[model samples]
Structures are given as C-alpha cells and as structure tokens.
Target: MDPLGDRVNRNGTPTVSDPSPGSEGGLALSGTRTLLLTTFTHVLVDGYGIGLSVLLALLFGRNGRFALVGLILSAYTLATAFAEPLWGRFSDATGRRGAVVGWGLVFASASFCAFGFVSPEGPWAGPLLILFALAAGAGAGTYHSVATALVNEVTSRENRGLVQGINNAGGSVGRTLFPLALAELAVVLGSPGWAVLPFAGAGVLLGLATVSAFPLASPRTFRAGTASPSPDGPMDRRFLARMVALSFLRTAFFVTAAGFLPTYLVAVRGLDERAMGTVMTLVMSTGILAQPLGGSLSDRLDRGRLLAGLLAGSGAAFAGSLLMEGLWSSVALLGISMFMVLMTFPLLFALMGDVVPGNRLGAATGLVTGAGGLAATLTQATVGVLAQRTSPVLVLLGLSALGVLSGWMAMGLRAPRSPGGRRALGS
Candidate 1:
C-alpha cells in the first residue's frame, strides 16, 4: 500500500497499480501487426547490419577491411548484450513499454540516416564510423529488447510457445529475404558512396511500427512480492545454471556458423559475399519452415531430448560439411548444416518459456540473451584467429564438439509442470 502524495505523517509507502481484467483484442492485433512490421524492419535493419560490412568492403577494398566488416558484423550483438537487461528492467519498472519503444525508433531512425556520413576519406570519418556503430547498436538494442518484452506482456502462457516460434520465424523471414533484396538495392543505389536511402526506408518502417503500437492496453501486473515459489524447488538457481551454460554453448555455435563457416568458404574455397548471401538465404528460409515444426515438436516431444537428438544430427551435418570434396557439394552440405543450426532457436525460446517464472520472465530472457551475445563476440574473434594458423576443418571440428556439448547440456534440462499441467514459468 502507498500513501497519497507522499504522506509525511511518520510513514513511508509506495502506490501499486490495480490489476486490469480482460484482454484487448485490439491490442493483441496491434501487437501482431507490430511483430509483422518488425519482421520486415528486421530484414532491412539486419540487411544494414550485416550487409553494411559487404558494402564497406566496396568502399575500402583492402585486406585489413575485413576487420572493419567484422566490427560491423559484431557490433549489433555486442550492443544488444549490454542493453537487453537494462531495457528489460526499465520496461518492468516503468510500465511505459510503448513510450520506450517509440523513442527507440526515433533514435534508430536518426542513426540510420546519420550513418551515411561515415566516409573512409573524410577528415572525421574514423570517429564517425565508431559513432555509427555505437548509435546503431544502442538504438537497435533498445528496440529489440522492448519489443520482446511486449510480446510476452500481451500473450498468455497457453500461446507463448507458439508465439515464440512466430517471432523467431518472423526474424528468419526478414533475414532470409532482406539480404537478397538489399544486394539488388545496393547495386541500384551504387552503394559505398550513397547508400542512405535504404537505411532511411528501414527507419521509416520502424517508425510506423512504433506508432501503431500505441493504445495498447496496460498489462495486469503480476504479484511479484507474494507469488509462491516454483514447485520445482530452487527455481532461480537451478534454471539460471541450466540456461546460462546452454545459452553460451548455443551462441558459441552460431558465431562459429556465421563467422568461421563463411570465412572458411572464402579463405579455403574462395567464394564472395554474393555467393555467401545466396547460401545464407536458403539456410534462413528453411528455418521459416523449420521453427514452426520445432515448436510443434516441442509440444509433442520431450524438448530437452529433442534438442539433444537435433544437436547430434546437426554436429554430424557440419562435420560432413567440412569434408566435402567440391564447391557445389560444400555449399549443399553447409546449407543443410545451417538449416539444422537455425532450427534450434525457437526451441530455445520455448524452453525459456517453459523454465522461467512468468513474473521475472523479461529479466531471465534478457540474461540468457546477454550471455549468448557475450559468448558469440568472444567466439568470433577466437575462430577468426584460429582460421589464420590452423586448417578450416579444425574450427569446424571444434564447433562439432560444441554442438555435442550443447546437446549434453540440453539433456540436463527437464521442463517440469505444475500440479495442473500449467507451466508457472511459461509467459
């Protein structure tokens, strides 16, 4: 209980909001629309995120330029790692999710346009490049964290698993198609000199999504102070231990897939960005189909067991990918391996919904994402150096081991149910 207007009568208190009953169909629809728009935005933004590196290659055209491309590739995740928990807590504390999201769009949109000023030969280019990285990352970080929180805020536990599939699928859809589209756009726009228009369009889409999310109904704040502990004893300690380690292994594998695998193709086999993007599109698009399959599989199958089985399969696929004798065969095997890699994400998100308490869901998700991002950043640099000295097969071998480790770790997790088969954790 809280006093009205800070009573000074020898007492201290805080006001709490009353729980709102009933769902707003409009808000749910609006959230759905926002997510759909977000998918489109993600494709373009991630297009800018990853494609910017290839574009920069055109600008610099130097061997050391790979370092610049690497920075561009890594910066988004690094920024998101630092910001997710902060934004999650902020959204939790204030309940101004829409406002936070709207403002995030403003920052992201401006940063996109501002990124055009980062020229290699200009006097201020070096510092401007750093600023572009910092701003793009910070803004993108805020938008994504808040958006994820909002998805949970509106969806019921019954549907969280399905929606997790949907969200990740949305992202896959974006990344899958966006690169091909942007590659064409880059050509039409004559990038490396003037490429601000595509980023500007992405910024506008973000703005539209943010504005349409207004009029969202406020959520019924859960009883955080009084909710009973999970029946699965020592929830926080056990779940955190399971999730953090799994997140690290999961992210480490993805970094290896995206960074080392591509570099291996280029260094050992000599393929360029266009060729790599073609393969990336196929791999990502498969997940648009595979994630729903994974989520449905999670419902019917033992999630932990399924994860283990998939990893063993995935590791074998990647290992075989390394041994391919020709370029065409290499691409085929890598595509299959990458598809296997993509299938894991929805299951992971669904598993989070299974294990974490609904009350503290945002924080828990943020922590998992942050841990993964940290691992990814470290893995990319390590694999890059590893590729320089040893054979590419060695890095693939290491990732194969990581996949096996991830499966073992997945085997350690058991999603328990409450007395009524209701997941107290599922958001």
Candidate 2:
C-alpha cells in the first residue's frame, strides 16, 4: 500500500480511510464508537452550558430581575473565547486533543458542581458564579473545536459533513433536553437551586463518559494543504476576508432567533412552559436534523450557494414568525429557520477544514468559533435589550432582514480555490 493510500482495513469491511489524512488504519467499530462518543460529549457539554441561560432567566426573573441575565450569558461566551483557541492550539502542538478534552471534562464537572454549590443568595455568589462560568465555558468551547477537528481528521470529506452535522445536532438535542428538564426540575422541587443537582450530576457522568470515548490524541494526517495558515496565500486571502463576516452573520442570525423566539411564543402567543418548551424544541430539533443533511448536501452541491440559501432561509423563517398566528404556524417557522442555520454550520466549517491544514485548523476554528460566540453574545444582548425597550417582533423582523441580505451575499461564494490548488497545500 502506498504510504498515503487510503484503504479498508481487513478487520473492518466497508470502512474507509480518510483519504485526506495520513492515518494508517481504516475505520472500524472503534471509529464508529469514537464518533458516537464525541457527538454525545458535545451534546452534553453544550446542554449543560447553553441550557444554563434558560435556568438563570427563570431563577432571576422569577424574582423580578431579568436585567442581569445577558451579563451572565455573556460570561460563558467570554470564557469560551479565551479558552477554546488555547485548548485547540495546545492540542495541535502536543497532538493530544483527547487529553485536553479529558482534562476539560474534569473542569466541566467541577464547573457544574460550583454552579450547584454557589448560591445567588450567598454573599459569596458573585465570585463563585464567575468561576462557574469560566469553568463551564472552558469545557463547552473545547468540545466543539476538538470534536470538529477530530471528526474531520477521522472522516473523509465524503461523509465529513454528515459527521459534523450529527455532532452539532447532538449538541442541539442536549441544549433542548437539559433546559426543559431543568425547568421541570425547578418546578417540581419548588426551588430553582434544586434544578441544579441533576445537571451537575449529569456533567460529572458526561465528563467521564467523554474522557473514555476518546483514545489518546495522536498525530493524524488529512487532505489539507499546509495544515497551517499563511497570510500571503491566495485561498487564505479569501478565507481571511470571509471568516469574520461569516462567523458574525451566522451568530447574529442564530441568537436573534434564540433571544427572541421564546419571548415571542410565551409573551406574544401566550404559550405555557410546556408549550414554550415544545416550540424551542421544535426549532432546535429541526436544526439538529438539518445538520447531516445539510453537510451531505454541501458535499454534493456548491457549498457557498448552499450557505447563502441557509442564511436566507433563516432570515425568511424569522420573517415568517411575524406572520405566525398559532402554535402550528409558529412551529413551522421555527423549524425552517433553525434548519437553515444548523445545516449551514457544518458546511461552513467543512470549507474551513478544507482550506485550513491540520495545524492551523484548530487555531482558525477557535478564532472563528470565538467570533461567532462573540457575535451570539452581542446579538443576544441586543435582542434582549430590544425586547425590553420595544418588541421582540421588531427584533425578529430586523434579524430576518439581515438574514436575507446575508443569503444574497452567500450566492457569490466560489468553491475555495487555492492560488495553486493541490500544489498550494502544505506550502
């Protein structure tokens, strides 16, 4: 076999070596296990972290202070920004993303425990909450970056999109389940803090499960160029120009939905908790489902055009929310909007993976993820403030308009061409 040749291992029929990577072996049951485990880890971490916002709002607003909610939410994003790239960089440099993530799980578990132990009523709450946010953020951010990189390293582009989508969907599912569970838990126990225990316990189990899922991170090769970045390069020139804007627009549209959708359902439409949860679930559920389909579609279609359509669809979905008259109508709009966003995500990341080499992939993804998270944070704050000062309907509408604009622009994305195609790789 050629040193770089991809082949099926005798032990695992139907398995494909990632043709792009230098991995010696073929996929096996072990490979499938890795994928499932990593995806599950993503969902759990995301659920524990993102779902906290919903719980926080409930805890704080139940007492008549919804003002500080965005601050608390932003703290998590801030932690993600600071930690994600550092973790990714370290993983690449040391070739130990698994260890990094495993250690991160330890932190994630500790974060939840801290959240459980720290009381808003405690005089010591402020510092403890900060600690919790940092710990939680650190864990959540690493999961996506590491998982994405790991997936790309292990899978061929042929199915890479599907894998990324499944992993993302898992995270969305976690986000959906955990919050609703916490909401129910909060009600049943008659104390918001009581809602904390289940999530905290789950985090511990999840951390251990995640650590066990990954083998020790080892050097893997892929069909990437230099696995690093060069400012002087042509493809990177386009990527550099595109990354921030793409990340910003993606998050802006997403948070616009997240920030306002619940409020719209509950406030304007008068959906109860169960109903509200159902609506949120539907939107995210669609997004989760959309991931693999979208990725695979991108594999077959022009990715740039697909991204444009996804963004535009998201915008239109938000626009449709204004016209939604009942639960079913709201559900439809929510489903379509989220599907657009979720499907677009893995495709965009795949593009990044294609252009970025193994070494730079982690760093670039970390930065873009940070940019997206930052955008999500800002959009959330803006939407919340707007919801407070005016109407969620208006905010949703404005965001929808932006989505339309982004889609129009996305139509122009050409398949990323290196100034020199294969020759430019690894230069």
Candidate 3:
C-alpha cells in the first residue's frame, strides 16, 4: 500500500518506477500543478534576468560606456555560470529542489531591487554594482537545473519534451514581457532603482508561494534516496562532452547577439528606447510558439537532426538579417532567428533527461547550462571590448557564424536510446 503504487521486490523494499505520468505518490498536486507552478516561477525569474538588459540600458543611457557595460554584464553571467553546478550538486544531495527554487528567487529579487537603488555615478557604484550582480546571478543560477529536474521527475518520456517546451515558453513570456514592462516603468518612475521595485516585489511573492506549495508538489518518493538509477545506464562521457561543447557554442552566439540586440537597435538602427523595447518583445515572443512546436517535433522526429536544422535555420536567418537594408526587414529576419534559437533550449533539456540517471539529472543539467553560461560570460566580455573597436553589427555577424558551427557539431549527437536499451553514445 505504498503511495505511488510502488511495487516491492522479494526483499520488501520498494522497486523503482517512473512516476505515473502526472501524480507522484497520489499527491494533490499533480504533475500538471507542479508544471504550472514552475512555469509561473520561470516567468518571474527569467523576466528579471532579461529585464536586467533594459535596466542596464536605462542606467547607462544611449551613449554610455560599452566597455564598462560589458564588464558588469560579464560579472553576472560568470557568476551564474559558476554557480549552476554547485547548486545542481546541492539539489541532488539534499533532495530539497523546492527550497533551492524558492530561496534562490527571493535572494535574487532582493539583490536586484538593491541594485536599482545605487547611483551609476557614485564613487562606490562600480564595486557595488558588480557585487549585486554577482549576488543576483548566484541566486538566479539555482533555478533551471532544479526546476527542470523536478518537472522531469513526474513527466513521462513521451511528454517530457512538450512539458519542458511549455516550461521554457514561460521563460520566453517573461523575456518578452519584462523588457516592455520595465521600460514603461522606467518612463513613469524616472528612477532605475525604483522601477525595479514592482517586479522585485512580484518575484518575492512568487518565491514565498513556491515554498508554501512544496509539500504538495514534492512527495518523498521523488526525493534522492527513494529514486533508482536510470535503466539507460551511466551517461556516455563522449556524448556529454559533445553536448557541453554544443551548449557552449549556442550560448556564446545567443549571448552575443541577443545581449547586444537592444544596443544594436538603438545605436546602429536609430530606434528610440520604446521602439527598441517593442522589437525586443516581438523577437522573444516568437519563442512562445516555436518552443512547443520544437518540443512536439522532438517527440516524433530525430532530436539530433531537428536540433541541427533549427540551429542552421537560426544562423541563416540571422545572417540574412545583416543583408537587409531597411530596419523592419532586418528586425523581421532577426525575429526568425530568435524564434529558432529559443526552440533549442527545451530540446537540450529533454535530451539530457533521456540519458542521465534520475538522481544525477540536476548535476548534468547544471554542467550543460553552466558551460553555456561560461560561454556567454566570455562572449559578452569579448564582444563588449570588440564593440568599441567596430560596429555591433559586425560583432553580431561573427557570433552568427558560431551558430552554424554549432549546428554542424549538433549533427554528431546520437539519438537517445529507449529505456532499457544500451546508452545512446559511445556504444
């Protein structure tokens, strides 16, 4: 009569089995409820992350120092990248994924709010800004690995891609909405710090809500010791190496292109702040549809091929954008690129779940995402310095080249084997 209908072996110990589609231990909060909660949290947290760009733009103004901007951006990105594996390891060890998600959001939100209050011109602003950025990044870093691991714990393999896609789309929603919301707040409040108050407050509330919902969403069966190893066997190191490399390249491209897109719009294309925010919103909005479509396709088609094609398509679209003369036309092309780029995230997450053991999922995810973060940090810093010497457009074009290379590299990923089959790679 164990909850979850867990079967017992001859020794009377519970035998490991996948959580049945949605319910974990017959808990009130089904997989659907957990998905919903995680998705909402994703919106707020990712919104804050993307919204930082808008805040940075506001604080620095149109003609501000690109070099300094890059450094500060790198600080956050680097810390986030560095913290991912640590947080992932912690989640795996403690069986407290909910605590990680809830507290991380609260800590990041508080730090971000504090960041808004510091004057850019103040004598201590440089040190203070970097410190806050590090704090916020570390807190934000705790999110994806744990939340995703939580989602996958309850979802069946058949639905994992779709569920992850929906979860990722929530991030897209945040990325899309936050920029405009923050921009509007900036216009109304006229103080960058005060503008962040509303969003930060929302994040704090969401974090508390997550903490309260933990017991219902996470049952003991889903905890570390209760779960068993994946039948897929130990992960292939070579395949993991390939994935990490792919993640690095894609992230570097994304960070370079999207990170500087707003600046490119304002400085290179001559758009006003409001207009830039609108275009940014439009670009990210594409992900809402693209992610689900990509996820659904991955379930039926070859994930490796789909991923390669998407990366190539994204790269082609981005390259095409550079050739366009008119601003709107270029924006249209860039929007398509953004669409395809966003689609790849859930695919990557789903791919990891397919091979990695249940208990090690968090750590593996952390490593993959952490690699991407590291790439982003380096790319952001490098491009920031290079932007001073050349146009942001050229810098973006160079980054777009990395996408094509990533696509080529993605072609090497073996399809994930079915459960009870031999491992997917190095077989």
Candidate 4:
C-alpha cells in the first residue's frame, strides 16, 4: 500500500494505531465518539457565548447606549483576544483540555447569572456589566482555543478536516440560533431577564457534564508515534506571519459584515425591519452546510489553495452584492458571500494544526486567534470611522478588497508536508 496517501491498518481502515488510555482492553472508541462529545460541548458553550451579544441590548439604555455598547463590546473582545494565548499555553502545560473547557464554561455561565441581578438604572450597572463582559469573554476565549486543540489531538490528520468541519458547524449553529431563540423567548416571557435564564441554566448543566467527561487527569489521545518521521522542516516565521495576516483578513471580513449589514439593508436597500432580519438569518444559516462541505473538500484538496479559492469566491460574492438589485438578488449574493467566507474557517484552522508541532497546538492556536482578534478589532474600528465619513457601501467595498488581499496571501503560503512525503496531518 502507498503510505503517502493514508495510513491504514490490516483491515484497510484508518484508525488510531494504539488504544487510547482507559479504553477497555485496548479497544478505543471510534473517532465518531470523540467528535460527538466535543461537538456537543462546543454547541452549548458557543451558544452561550454568542447569546451575550443579545444581552448587550437588554443591559444598556437607549440614551448613550450605542457608546456604552461599543465600550463593553470592545472590552469583551480585548479580554477574549488577550486571554486566548494564556489559556492555550496553560493547556499545553497541563494537557488538561477538558478541565480547561469545563472551568471556562463554569465562569462564563456564572457571568450570565450575575447579569440578572444588575439594575440598568443604577450608576454601578454599566461598570458591572463591562466587568461581566470581560469575564465571559475571557472564559469563552479560553474554551475556544483549547477545545480546538483537543479536536486536532484526537483525530488523525487524514480525518481531521472532516472533524473540524463538523466541529465548526456545531459552533456556528449555536452562535446563529441561540440569539434568535433568546429573542423569541423574550417575547413569550415578557421580560428579557426571564428569557436569559435558560442560557445560564444550560451553561451550568453543560459545565458539570464537561467535568464528568474528563474523569482521569489524562486520557490516552491521538499523538504522533515514535515510528513517524519528523516534520519536513522547522516552523517558518514567515509562514506564521502569513497565517496571522490571513486570520486578520478573515476576521475583518466577518466583523465588518456583521457590523454593517443590518444598517445597509435598512438604509441603502430600503428593506423593512422584518426583511432585514430575514436576510441576516439567511446569511448566518448558510454556514451550517457550507462549513462541513468546505472541510470535506479540504481533506481531498490542497488546504491552502482551498482557502484561497474560498476567499476569492467570497470577494466575488461581496462584489455581486454591490451590483445586484432587488431583494432576492441581494439575498442570494450575500448568502453566497457568507457561505464562501465561513467555509474558510475550518480550512484555516486545519492549516494551522498541520504547520505546528502537536505539543504546541494549544499555544499556536491561541497565538493566531489572539493576534487575529486584535487585528480585527483595530480594522473594525477603522471601518466604523470610515463609515461615518463615507457611505456604508463604500466601507463594505473596502473590506471586500481586504478579502481579496487575504486570498493572495493565502496563495503564497506553503502547504506543510507530512512525514513520508504525504500531506501534513494539518493538511
């Protein structure tokens, strides 16, 4: 058999060579089990995290609300951005991915419950809310980086792409749906506070489950065997820089779209509130299918090229939105743009895993995520300023240009080769 394509056991199925520690009699559960547990946890935690965005409206006032929201959101983003690397490095040191995720969920959930007590009328309310945002953002940030590292750890490179796709889809579902669900609950419950209680409750329950999921301090997990050859070359600083640039571009695209799309729909397109909501929903929901499809393709194709192509597609779709007329045409173009953009996430993450050493997965993930967040924050602020000076359409066009530039950067990145001249596990 050609080892360069994929590693297979005697029966010709790809499986981890050795049984994970604690499996009964050397019988490890299939990667399916790994994907299920991790993905479930991801949905719950990420749902809760995204739900915080909804809470911002409930927690602040109409007067000075925009400024206050901006301040708190910036605090949250900064907290998450800075905390990712620290928690990632800590996970690498302890090799306790589950525990890290568990604690992160606990603290994040507690922050939600704390919000219930905050009186928006009181002077202390705004300060307390900012603090909560920071804490919640920190926890969610920690959970995100470590959990991704854990996913890469348990799956072979040959199968990692699909697993990441599934994993990303789960998180995207949580992020997209949770806020809408909360809005619906708010209508039925007649108070935003009552609506938010379920999120806190779910977080607590999920936190306990995370604790149980990691009974042993350490479990046997996917690791490169001694018989495997070393990476073809040392980590390249230039390659790292390329990744950071790509991440920045990706984040900028998302933040700008999310920040401005609603305004554009209402102001430029003459859409009513109902139509605007529908368009936004369609944009996010497209990712549920797009992510998995992209991941599956990444497994069979060159990841770098796939990412570049996706970015280029996203840019073209964004350009389409500029020229398209009528409601359906705009929706279709924007949806395609979202699909193309969101699909790049799993591919970019898988590429990062392939380029770095296994032991350093947590730190590497943290560095890129953190740096990307910071860069995106700066870029978004610049766009906000630009939007004030120019038209929203103009601002969006500039952001789309960034996407094309990012695709070019991705095109220049080297695909790391796995041992035996095959694709890297990250590929």
Candidate 5:
C-alpha cells in the first residue's frame, strides 16, 4: 500500500491506503498546526503591510492630490515589484526562509512606525513618507513570496490546494480588516501616521515571537514523498516567461478595472461616494471567499481548464456589467466578475508551484508576482489615460479583451510534474 494515503484517483481524490508506522501521511496534525501558524503570519504581514495606501489618504487629508498620491504609491508598488524576485532568489540560495520572513517583518513594521514620527509640518515630510513607503514595499516583497514557498514546502500535494486556499483567505481577511482598523485608529488618535504605529509595532513583535518559535514547531525536513527532485533540476526559462506574461496580463485586467470601478460607478451610474464605497465593499467581500473556493476547486479539477473557465466567466460577467442598464444589474454582474478575478490568485500561483522545482519555488513566485505588479501599475495608468480621453466603458471593454487573452494563455498552460514526480493531473 502507498504510505502517503493513496494514489489520487482520476477525479483527483485520494483512495484508501495503508501507512507504515511513523509515516508522514499520518502527521496531519503537525502539518495543520504549521499551516495555521503560517496563515496567521500572512494575516499580520499582508494586512498591515498594505496600509501604505491607507496611509497615503491620511497624509493628504481632504485635499489629497491624485498626482502626488499616485507618485508615492507608484514608488511603493514598484519597489515591491522589483524586490520580490530578489528576495526569492536570496531565500533559495540561503535556505533561511524563516530568518528572511522575520527580518522582513521587522523592516516593514519599522517603516510603519516611522510614519508616526514624520510630521506634516516638517519640510522633509514628503521625502520621509516616500522613504518609508519604499521600505514598506521591500518588506512586502520579502514576506509574501517566502511565506508561499514555506507553505508549499510543508504541505503535501493532496492538501496543498486547501491549505493554500486557507492561506489566500487569511490574506483577504487582513486586506479587508486591517485598513478599516487603521482608519478607525486614526480617528481616535487624530493623527493618521501615529494611528497605525501601535498596531504595526504590535504586529512586528508578534511576528518576531512567531519566528522565534518556528524552530521548535517546523518540520525537521521537507518530506521526500511530497515532491521529487527534478530530473535536470534546472530552471525552465520558457515556462517562467510564459507564466510572467500570463500573470502580467491577468493582473493588469484586475488592477485596471478595480482601480477605476469606483470612478466608473460615480460617473456612469450617478452613485455618490458613499454608495460607491458600499458597492466596492460588496465586490471585495466576495473575493475574500472566492480565493479559497477557487483553490479547492483547482486541486480537484485540472488547473489549466479550471483557470480558463474562471477567466472566461469573469469576461462574460464583465461584458454583461458593461451592457446592463440598472444599477443592481451592473452591481451583480460586476461583483461576480470581481469574485472570479480574485479567485484566480491562488490557482495561478499553485499552477506555478506544480511546475517549478522545489528549490526554486521562491524565485518562481517572486518573478511572477513582481512582473504582475509591474503590469498592474502600467495597466492602471493606461486605463486612467483612456478614461480621460475616451469612456470608462471603452476602457472596461479593453480590459475584458485582456481577460479573454489571459484565459487563452491559461488554457495553453502545459501540465507539469511536481518535485515528487507526480503529474499535476491524471492522464
């Protein structure tokens, strides 16, 4: 009998298997414990790490200049985009994933706390804010890709999808709650910069503490059964290029549409700021759940086919939103589209994980994520310009076209073997 439970059947479900004594297959408790801890780490890192955007709003107050805000945000995002791949390569070379993550949190948290010290009255305020933004960006880059690789290392293939789903869900929770928490804290403190300091510091301390405990809790060695060493063990540059291209296109579609959705609703649907915010919230809330659902489904189904279907559905929904007349109809279609778009997050990365060698998971993740970020930045700018010169609907139609292209790319993805010598899907 196979010791790692059973061989996955045609439907991707495992059948019955007998395990030897002390086998890794029975260590579900330890694996799950590790997963939960990792998930919590993501919450702290991603939740507060993304607070720079919120911080920008607080810095400018009611008279926020779009150009200035965009400049600083662009710096932050680009810094993150550029740094991810480097961190991934560093982690792969050093084999000190925990140390990288712990130190990264420290750097990010310090950047957040530093925000409190930058006075609006000071002449150096803008420059100081930019410095902290870049620091935060670097920290964000370090945390996510390393954490993803760590999770992939610890979990078995049978459960990786579910666990990664949970991981993505944790990030969503952070993204949803952290900004609101920071905003409320700003109200109480009457200083936007100072408001996030306490929370950021607390997160830092907690993260460091968690890292300290990792040595005791983490698996002694990555289980050999989970992945096999690659035959050549060399990077597949062509596959990486394709992944980067596809990721860029998909991320561009999401970032452009989301960045402009509020404006579109206000201009086209005549909704006020508050109502638009409500609609936006409604759309984002669905994403929190959609990621996990998508991941779980990807694990059970063929990832390429599943991803293609999702993108196509999203495109169809997006097109419907453009054509729909009523506000409710538009909201329903757009919300569904947004949910499908967000769901692609885990599926795409997990697909990469399947193809990427275990030793280079970090680098692969970093490269794709960084490229995607850069694409999002460019796409947002392009969409903004187009909206100014043409119409919001026209820009969205273009985005829908990109979505279709992305789906085609996903459909063209080749099934690659895991490090454990397992095919991604049954033949």
Candidate 6:
C-alpha cells in the first residue's frame, strides 16, 4: 500500500486505498491535525509577506523616495518568484515538506528581525535592505507549494475544496491582522523599526514551535510506494500555458491594487498611518469570508463561470471606488472589489488540484505562484515608476481595466472531464 493511501489501478486511473482495519480513525485524526497546523503556520508565512509592504510604507513615510522603495520591494518579490519553483521541486523530491515549512519560517523571521536593526539613513542601508529582503522573500517562498502539497497528500478528494478554502482563510486572517498589529505598534512605540522587531519575534517563536511539533504530527519518512508518478500522465502543455497566463494576470491586478494600498492611502489619499492601516485591514478582512464561501460555491457551481463573474465584479467595483468622492464610500467599493478578487484565489488553487496529479502538484503550484510573484514584481516596479510622474490612482485605473480583461479570459476556461463523463468542479 502507498504511504499516503493512494494507488493506480490496471486501467491507469488513480484511486485512494482504504486504511487498514482499526487504522482509519487514527489516519483521520492525523490528517486533521496536519491541516490545522499547516493552516496556522500559513498565517505566519503569509503575514510576513504582506506585512512587509506596510512596514516599508511606514519606514519611508509619505514624503520619502517612491522609486527607491519600489525597487526595494521588487527585490523581495523577485527573489520569492525565483525561489518558489526551486523549493517546490526540492519538497516534491525529498518529501521533507515539514522541514521546508518550519525552517523557512525561522529564516524569514530572523532576516526581518535583523532588518529592524538597520537604520534607514545609514550609508549601508540600501545594500543591507536588499540583502535581508531577498533572504526574507526566499524563505517565505518555501511555504506555499510545500505546505499546500502536504495538506493535499493527507486530504480526501471530496473535501479538498473546503480544506483549501479553510487554509487560505487562515492566510487572509494573517494578512488582515499583521498590518494592523504593526500599525498599532508603530503608534505605540513611535517607530516602525522597533514595531517590526516584536512582530518578527513572534514569527520566530511560531517557527520554533512548528519545528518541534510538526515532526511528531507529520513524519519525515518516504518510501518507494509514495514515489509513483501521477496516473493521469503528464499535464497538458496547453492547459499549463493557460493556467500560467491566468495566474499572471490575476496576480498583476491584485499586487497593483493591494500591494501599494498603504502608500496609496497615505501618500495619495492623505490618510494617517493608523487610518491607512485600518483601511488596509478592512480590505483584506473580506478575504476571510470570501475564500471559504467561494470554496463552497465552487464545489456546487461551475468554477470557470464563477471565477469569471467574480473577476468582472471586482473590476467594476474597483472602477466605482475610483469615481467615488467620499473616502468611506471609496473604501466600501474597494472592500467589495477585494472580496470578489480574493474569492478567486482558492478557486484557482482548487482548480489546479482537480487536474494535476498529486505527485506533481508541488512543481505545478510552484510554477503558477512563481508566475504570480513575477507579475507582482513587474507591476510593483511599474507602478512605483509611474507614481513618480502621475497619480497612483491613474495607474490603479489601468490595473482595473486589466482585471476586466482577465475576466474575459477566464470565461474560456473549463474543468477537465472525469471518468464518469461529467465535468469536475475545478479544472
């Protein structure tokens, strides 16, 4: 029997095997524990990733150099894009998924903590910032593919969508809370640098905890039975291309809108740091509800059409937000846009799970997320440069237009057919 309880029949179809008598209950408990732990750690990893942007905005202040800050931010994203596939491949090969997750958290947290000690005005600041940011990004990049694959390995197909949604919701919670916590800390501590230390310290503590606990919960053992290739054969090249394109455009839209939101609120909207943080928290909080709901809906509806509608709705809402005169009204519209856009994340991931074989999931996920990270890097660089000459709001309007185009592209996507001659929930 395969270590993960999966096997291929003579007809080449993959099916899960039943656990040994009396072992089923233990397996279920183990899987649940793994899911919960992975989800919580996801909170730390994603929190550091998103919260870094807010920290940068706080450090630079409203009147600081936009282009330089953009380059610095781009370095972090570019490093992450470059490292994701490498980490994914490694995890897939070694089956050391827990090691990647645990160590990555530690390394990234330590790097960020080191960053807190560097004075912004010092001569060595630029080089040091880039170095630490790159380290942090690379470390943070290890979680998504490896951890998601770990979760998928243990979960049953019937509940996969809901499981992914729950995991993703944890990330959204992190994104929502971490920035607010940092902003509140800045207010109380009177310095962004000092504020970051405590947050990073928390990550270190969590990393240590994960490292200690994960080994007992998720064994590091790998056997030949678990090394079989996917029974579905190699993934279709055309499908890979389409998924990559969708991932790229979706990420470009998200990063352009949300990545720079703090700067946009502070520099463009003239909001104070606390108010900017609050608005950002509000915008990101929508994902907590949106992802799980979308996950449930995806299981019941046509995922392609649902994703298309959500993307289109996000574009329209974003455009409406730009036209609103009142700050709160604009915030309300932006929140709606965020809600719709965030829903698509789990849908896309679940779609990938539906089509890709379990053995190759890590590599495939790495590729898609790497593309998204690249898009974020490019979009951030462009937005930063453009903001120097024009209003950030104008650049955001352009992104909103692209979001609509992404929606049109999504309309053509279809889920793969199952052996029963019915379309699957995700393709």
**TM per prediction:** 0.78, 0.82, 0.89, 0.82, 0.79, 0.89
Better of 4 and 6 by lDDT: 6
Q: Which tens-of-lDDT digit does each residue in 112-184 have in candidate 1?
A: 6676556677887656766776676666665545655656554444455556567667666755765455445
Give the number of the best model, judged by lDDT.
Answer: 3
Expressed as tens digits, the lDDT of each residue in 1-427 for candidate 6 is 3223345444433355544445432235445666777788878777777787787778675774566667777888888888887888887776667667888888998887777667778899878988988999998888877777777666544455667778888888988997788898888988767877876787787777667655422332222222222225677667667888887888788866777778777887888888988998998999899988887788778788898999989988998898888999999999999999988877787777777776687888889888988998898888888877787678778879868877887887877787789875444
Clashes of 5: 4
lDDT score, candidate 4, position 38: 64
Q: Candidate 3: which stretches are off by over 4 Å? A: 1-29, 215-232, 419-427
Worst 10 residues of 5 by lDDT: 1-10
CA lDDT scores, all candidates in order: 0.59, 0.65, 0.78, 0.68, 0.68, 0.76
Q: lDDT per residue, candidate 3, 1-427, as tens digits? A: 3333444444434444454554432322345667887898888878877777777776664774566667777888888898888888888776667768988999999998998898987999878988998999998898887888877776666666777899889999998998777777778888877789988998899888787666222332442222322334677788789989999999888766776777667767777778878988999889889888788788777788889999988998998898799988998999999999888888888888777887788888899889999998998888888886787668777878889988998999988665578444311
lDDT of 4 at 342: 79
Q: Tell how far residue 164 is off in model 5, in angstroms.
A: 1.0
Clashing pairs in 3: 116-193
- For model 5, the superposed segments whose C-alpha errors exceed 4 Å read 1-30, 57-64, 113-126, 187-189, 215-220, 223-232, 256-281, 315-331, 381-401, 417-427
Q: Between prediction 3 and prediction 4, which has the larger TM-score?
A: 3
Off by over 4 Å in 1: 1-49, 52-68, 109-130, 143-145, 192-196, 215-218, 221-235, 260-267, 389-393, 421-427
* lDDT of model 1, residue 119: 65
Quantify how close model 2 is to the true structure by its C-alpha RMSD in Å.
6.1
**1-427: candidate 4 lDDT, tens digit per residue:** 2121123445433344453445432113433454566677677666665455455544432232444544555566677778888999998787666778877877877776676557778889778988987787787777667878777765556656766888888877776676567656765676666876877787778777776665333232332331221123466678778887788777767655654565566556765444554566677788788888888889888898989988988987887787777678978888898888879878877776667776677887888888777765666556655655576577678788877877887998888765579665446
lDDT by residue (1-427, candidate 2, tens digit) is 2122323334321233343443233343334555676777777776766466655545454342333455556677777867777777777676566556666766776676567555677777656676677778877778666767766666654555666777777777876786567666666887656776766676667667656544444335332331222122333656645765777777767754664455455666765555666667666777667887887787777788788878887888878867777768868877777778778878877777766776666777777777777776776666666766776577668877767776776766667555565322211
